[model samples]
Target: MAAESRSRILIIGVTGNLGFELAKASTAASHPTFGLVRDSAFSDPNKLQKIQNLSNHGVQIIKGSLQEEDGLIEALKQVDVVICAVASAQVLDQKLLISAIKRAGCIKRFFPSEFGGDPDRTRVSNLDHGFYSTKAEIRRLVEAEGIPYTYISCNFFASFLLPSLIQPGLQTLPRDKVNIFGDGNVKGVFVEESEVAAFTISAVDDPRTLNKVLYLRPPGNTLTMNEIVDIWEQKVGKHLVRNYISEEELLQKIHETPYPENMQMVFIYSVFVKGDQTYFDIASSNGVEGTQLYPLIKYTTVSEILGGML
Candidate 1:
């Protein structure tokens, strides 16, 4: 195993939120970084701008896709590591990626698109959730192919969960009220996106993380929903009306929700309200302390995130 700086890194789905940040971090580390984008992504103004930004930062843009085997294999042949940051909806498509990686035979490390909770420890009943199930499938595929890989169980992304719990695009606390799933007592790990990216890049060639599930549970970032709300209240100096959605009600919604976005909400309810995300103890013998690996990186806490939003 070699340091990530010495490895040629290719990040798939570089136009995405996590992928974009990862490409930036990889380039910052002076790794020869390449970003994989679909040929069509260049046509859209927003995606094109993101691609251009990565290009400006010295990321070589490779125009190909997981679906296009020949082009993907050719793109992968130049890299030692491949990090897939594809969206949840696109998780199943990684099968094509796995095939390409095997065909390329040059990739020494492969990171699948799992930057959330530990799917291995998730209960079988909840495994059917598209988000977790697809991730599980990809993990199995990666293992079956014997690809040297790292699986990151980053819990929740603070940027996503904070705004998502209330409303998308609303970066502040709810004005008058907020929904509290269950009793808000269940604790879950939350990691900042940039920190996750930094850790992933650092772990790219770290032997300890190879073929291991890297859990991103920095002590400061692990808190229950109640604690998060209290911190928010303290930061804004206002008590929001707490509307509690019981476990029973959320389970019913999980069963009944038809819309994809609402179904995603149901999945969130499954994770937070039902306590599915915190099933594993990261401090236990099974977990790897992420902060211990890179002591210099000051991981962001909920309060810091809230303060920045204010």
Candidate 2:
């Protein structure tokens, strides 16, 4: 534990959900944690409050921007590991970070901003989704630079999907009706955000996970959309009218949706409907299962999430 604590950890985009959770977990584990915040974050009340909260929790703030190479290099000099939790759209900005890491020459481990589906298997020629493509590019850059790194392919975030599904949102799953894409039998692993953070922090110093893709599929967390809805119905003691959207309709949406968010959703829906999220099996000998590695870590399953929905 003392040796682990000696690892000075730094997280980019700490204002974001994953980054904040990772910072909190790192601090709780007695690791010397540092968070990078943009100078503009100090002006925004919400971001400022979050920064204060992180500070109160013992995270030192390194004020800078990804665009500024000099500032980034200076910041990198203070930490041994760099965990990037930046948004999908801002993933390309990691080029600047990669450059700084090479220049600083001190970071022992680099965890790129890949917290979603595996990009290697999800590529569609016409789709050109920057979310996945940009992440792939970053991976190439990290490898090209010969940086010691770990890429975490944490599948879908269960907490993120729960609210988006239950509440009145883009992909609405109302109390009385739920939308099912394709055959709805495709299984995908959905991990909670905090669990992803916990497992990630735990793996930072573990030599076994170095330069590997750490998968976050817990034992019971894998389930299809239909299976998830079924669990919800069993928990609520009420059935939801299932509405199936055919593959043709989803493909049309992907082509016609003008809004970037909606287009992204269509791409995501295609992934889930096609079962691309489960392309890699975490139980395989080559895979690093989070819960198995850290026996005491409790992963939140879809059943538990559905039961908590009110």
TM-score of each: 0.90, 0.92
lDDT of each: 0.81, 0.82
The local distance difference test score of model 2 is 0.82
Which segments of candidate 1 are over 4 A away from where they belong?
A: 1-5, 124-129, 164-172, 283-287
Candidate 2, superposed: residue stretches over 4 Å from native: 3-5, 164-173, 282-287
> What's model 1's overall lDDT?
0.81
The sequence of per-residue lDDT tens digits that candidate 1 reaches over residues 1-310 is: 3444489999999999999999999988888999999989999999999999999999999988888999989999889999999998899999998999998899999999999877776653452446677788898899999999888888789877675443323555676778778888877667889899999988887888888878887877777778888888887788888888887876676567655546556545656666666765665625576788888878988778877877
User: Roughly what TM-score does model 1 have, to 2 decimal places?
Assistant: 0.90
lDDT of 2 at 137: 93
Summing lDDT over every window of 10 consecutive residues in candidate 1, give the lowest-scoring window: 163-172
Give the best candidate by TM-score. 2
lDDT of 1 at 241: 87
Q: Which pairs of residues have clashing backbones in candidate 1?
A: none
